[model samples]
Target: MKKAEDAQRLLRTLSTEMPEGWKKDYAGVRNEYRQAMEDAARQAALEINQTDPEVIEQFKKLRDDLFSSLSNHQARWPVLLLSEQRSVEYRQSVQAFEAKHSEFVRFMRQST
Candidate 1:
């Protein structure tokens, strides 16, 4: 969860503080964010120890949703630095990702 939050912050910084040569910088940020998310997901998998099958399934679904949200946000990166329209779309994608992340966090807290 901390890793995911850090990745989210990194992405927000990348979007808002783009340097002059943004394309090159974006690639590095993108890689970092991807690695962070992967780490977070792995940690989440290891941490979930619910005995109930249904609860386990719920956790799995939430984890999948979180990753799917991250993927959707990542898909917007290339076009995100291109134009105002793309920027708007990118913002929307970020909002969607954050929503999923919040949902995951809430569920995790409840389960724990």
Candidate 2:
């Protein structure tokens, strides 16, 4: 019961902090990529004719490009986190924290 309560507390703290940490850690690059993607999506939406197959393909391409850009932006975080020299003793713990927090995040996203 005590362990369960501790785990629950940890989950709540982690679920909030992890995303905040990620935003703080990568806000500049992430926001830049997001802004670019949103701008391009908006422009494409205005010009795209959904009924035409060629236009539809172009929209798909735009989406893929956005995803690729975001993916590249996001993929840098783990490497940075792992190699961070400030906490040399806690690298394994950091990895574990990432895994656990990721699971919590995934569950929250799926549930909501």
lDDT of each: 0.71, 0.45
Off by over 4 Å in 1: 76-87, 109-112
For every model shown, the clashing-pair count is 0, 0
Over 19-100, each residue of candidate 1 has an lDDT whose tens digit, in order, gives 5776566677667766776776666666777567887899889989988877766665663455434556666777888888
Can you give the lDDT of residue 28 in candidate 1?
71
lDDT (Cα, tens digit) per residue for candidate 2, span 1-112: 2332344355334434565454344444334534654554555565556577765665566455545533543464432453324354454444554454344333323322
Please report the TM-score between candidate 1 and the true structure. Answer: 0.74
Tell me each candidate's TM-score: 0.74, 0.36
Q: Against the hidden true structure, what lDDT does model 2 obtain?
A: 0.45
**Range of the 10 consecutive residues with the lowest summed lDDT in candidate 1:** 78-87
Candidate 2's displacement at residue 11, Å, is 33
Q: Give candidate 2 regions above 4 Å deviation.
A: 1-26, 76-112
